[model samples]
Target chain A: MIPVSVTRDDVAHVARLARLAMSEQELDQMHGYFEAILEHFAKLAAVDTEGVEPTSHPLARANVTREDCVTEPMDRTKLLANAPLADGECFLVPQIMEDE
Target chain B: MNDMADDIGLLNRPAHELAALIRSGEISAVAVTEASLARIEALNPTVKAFLTVTPDLALEAAKATDDALARGEELGPLAGVPIAIKDNLCVDGVLCTCASKILDGYRAVYDATVVERVKAVGMPIVGKTNLDEFAMGSSTENSAFFVTHNPWDLSKVPGGSSGGSAAAVAARMAPLALGSDTGGSIRQPASFCGITGLKTTYGRVSRYGLVGYGSSLDQVGALAADCVDAALLTAVIAGQDPRDTTSADVPVPDYVGELTGDVTGLRVGIVRELMGEGIDPEVRESVLTVARALEGMGASTGEASIPHIDYALPVYYLIGPAEASSNLARFDGMRYGHRTKERAADHIEMYSRTRAEGFGPEVKRRIMTGTYALSAGYYDAYYLKAQKVRTLLRLDVEAALGQFDVLLSPTTPLTAFGIGELVNDPIAMYMADICTFAANLAGVPGLSVPCGFTKAGLPIGAQFTGRAFEEGTILRVGDAYQRATSHHTSLPGLLGAGG
Candidate 1:
């Protein structure tokens, strides 16, 4: 039996939030994977993690201060060469905002 | 070499030795480069290790190495040795796809720090090799381009996402290659290919241009045929870079020089958790054999515990994907790479469609998982909780390392599996990484050395992870092991039988 923490629809919702479009079939597949993996992740709930701090970076420094000086930037022409759509200097997007 | 003229067998020799030959003008760098290109052309068709073959770049770099020699300039240790960069790293004017269709048409405008260092040291940039899309899988099967077969047995996978680099070195396509390890990507592949790979301490190498995966977990390191070559290549890339603030300001040690061929009194710990269940009997024996080998060299071996390591798979799955979903978010259609042709009513549709068309299944699966975990309402339950447990994992590893200089285990629970074996079962595939990922979580250095071969003859690897920033100790022990053992000396028959 698959543990149903998330339904197929919920996967689609998350995919949407992730800015990824998925077909009904891909969502179904992702749903199955989520159940299996999240079921394994459920084991973490049993650990007594009380008073334990969250570790964001393994080699975290108290602070990282870089010199606030100008640095060389990538060539605009070269960067644009990598883009799928470029108009003069700016990247050409499909459209700005859909009519509300 | 003056000893042997015309560069006959230079293709398979160690990078350091090849550089020495080039330095002495015994073998002209051009001759060595041509030899390397010939071997790669002959073997790459079957091994499929390289995604791009930049013969022109290789020759150009070799010419520079020769010019340096002609001018009597002192060259770096790896000078004139050809190298394969994993496709994920940015190499200027070269393709940087990360093996994803989403990034298919992209070429880097600048070089990754590691790529820059490789150039600085005078090694030829042979080409970019394949990887799992977005560096996301245990096997190279996830590469959008194609799978890289294990050099040992053509039917099996070269463990990924550094599989191509490992195969290239293993096949003698190149003497050195660089791979990134987010979770055993470098070590597992090197182990499967019967070569040496090192994952430097988290901040040990600059991450300025590695296409971000698990930002905190990822590190760029070396893949080579042995410890000396691995250390030489690693030394060239390891150091602080102001561009990557996470890169520590620690002094880079003479990794190659530190391999003194002695490990007397070195403390080795056999991680009891890593050696137990879920690990194959043969692989367990192989790891124990490695410990015994160390013992024979006068290094003390004892059982060490890091019980929380049991949860590492779950923790990594949560954290890696969570970070990946964020890291991969930049691939929207506007900037670079594949853009959807289908009509879209809005820009969001364009982004959604672009990604849907761009990402491979494994990549999408991870992105969805990450998005779900990091999404509102589940952040604390999933992402935050995993981070806190990561703290427990760090403390456990810290305690274990405090007692031992290096902790040892099987790099993978088993040797290479057949191509189609675990592709359908994600959980089974994730389980293979359990032995190697904890070091990434702890930001410690991990090295995988070829220990033995399986009954079926696939290479077996034993992992040695050391205290953070203690890469020298692990490399010294690995070099000593290689000096004492013959497992790393065997090459694939394909190299010999290839046309």
Candidate 2:
């Protein structure tokens, strides 16, 4: 069994970190789901993994770099076509600061 | 339309055969496009596979192919073939929603590498098919839109997040389709829908335009009616892309030409852990039957142990969610995609509210789980531990592959279950991926081929996983099996009634 228990507060804190807003009902539901998922993951502790290197990629390869050559860029009109709010060539978002 | 369906029955022919017929002038590309469009129109309401259909674009591409053929220009193997694309792959000017509300009105400005290649080869993209929101679930029930039904039985799930692609192929709505497998998205659905699906080795196919779920585990692949068609599609799409750094700079082999149908000297291993408890008896019997058939063809089969196989699901859930948490951070409602209409005091409020409104319950759960796992105090115990266990699983698979040419197992623990049976239980839903995720964790190539049907008439899939960059080996074995058996020829009952 998972040694750590997930409470409603814990779920809410994690959601805040993830930048997701959850209601009271959803938070309660997430608490139970989190506990169950942790219990499933508890089995991993049984394996003896000493001095094993973690694999981040399937095959071993180094970071690839290319010569800094300029290429034609995508048209700005096309780029802004999907933008929810666009002002001229710039993206519009909610005001960042409040008037003091 | 009936006459057109009768004359060519474009839906029933293999993709390669259709290409040949189109090239020979026996059938016009326009007629084939019309027939496929008609089929989609008639069946899409019932199957709910396609999220967007593009008849005008398809006809335009078909006209170009016909014009090129008339001029005697040599075209690629997939010329004039109609195919469906999974919604997650970007197609320029098309609404490329990853089946998530967050990307509600987003349209792609550029084509995904695979999409560019297929279009270059003259494949008419008929539509974008439905998928689980962000390709996060094992069933299409997680889709923000309608669920894609299993053509074999409407009440059962078609398997997902590639469910729409597999369902389209099974229902003969399209001859070929593209799917991305982060874990078992492609293979499980292929098995459930009774079609052929291949998950290419990680970095084998470019992930340039694929919406990231698990960046390290995701690979774009093909779903088709049979092994040769799958191989043909793979040959067209597999190779290095300069834009995607992780794409291996390896030579693209003649995948289709390599089907020697000879597994005589091949040694096969049945993963002992995969067939044990929790697997449905019928699914296990079908997989064993495939092993016996392989042995009958002069191939040797033996039991091999990958002791760490049991940990694949847990390891995958951890790694997949961690990567997803980071990759999905781009959709903050600042520049594109969905934005909150409610008044926000500041940008932070906008981001949080947009995401809360945009993501579904399953997506939110994964994001929270990953955030907790990667949190400051818990990283070592959860994330790091899972990574270390992942290494052990990879090594175990490598050791087994060292002994055998390929490993075999059931693609899923059971046949397709009812749509909502496991939806409410997250762990139970995850168990459906037990037999398939080891290949992803190891970054190896895996293929799901139709083996037989359960007594209730649901399809059973037998999986063949080969070493990294050795997709040819498994494809050869899968082709040999298809040649020997008639299972792949059987269609869903609805297809018999002119659907």
| TM-score leader | 2
Candidate 2 chain B lowest-lDDT run of ten: B1-10
Model 1 per-residue lDDT tens digits across residues A31-97: 8988888788898888888899999998767678867898788789988887788986998876656
**Global lDDT of model 1:** 0.89
Estimate every model's Cα lDDT from 0 to 1.
0.89, 0.90
Give the chain B TM-score achieved by candidate 2.
Answer: 0.98
- B1-499 per-residue lDDT for model 1 (tens digits): 2322233366667888888888888888888878877777777899898999899999999999999989999987888888999999998999888999998978888889999999987889888998888888888999999899998899999999999999999988888999999999999999889999999999999999999999999999999989999899888999999889899989998988899989999899999998878888989998898899899999999999998987898899999999999998988888889999998988898899999999999888888889888988898888988999899999999999999999998999978999999999978998778889899998999999999988998999999999988899999999999999989888787755321
Q: Whole-model lDDT, candidate 2?
A: 0.90
Tens digit per residue, CA lDDT, model 2, B1-499: 6664473356788888888889889987887888888888878999999999989889999999999999999877889999999999999999998999999778988999999999998899999999999999888989997899999999999999899999999988889999999899999999999999999999999999999999889999999998899999998889999999999999989998879999997999999999989999999999999999999999999998899988998899889998888888888988789998988887777788999999998898888888888998878888888889989999999999999999999999999999889899878998889988999999999999999999999999999999999999999999999999988888888776543
Span of ten consecutive residues with least summed lDDT in model 1 chain B: B1-10
Tell me the TM-score of chain B in each candidate: 0.98, 0.98
DockQ of 1: 0.64
**How large is the interface RMSD of each prediction?**
2.9, 1.7
lDDT of 2 at B59: 91
Alpha-carbon deviation at B354 in model 1, angstroms? 0.5
Model 2 DockQ, alpha carbons vs. true complex: 0.71
Question: For model 1, what is the error of residue B292's alpha carbon versus the real structure, in angstroms, after optimal superposition?
Answer: 1.3
* Candidate No. with top lDDT: 2
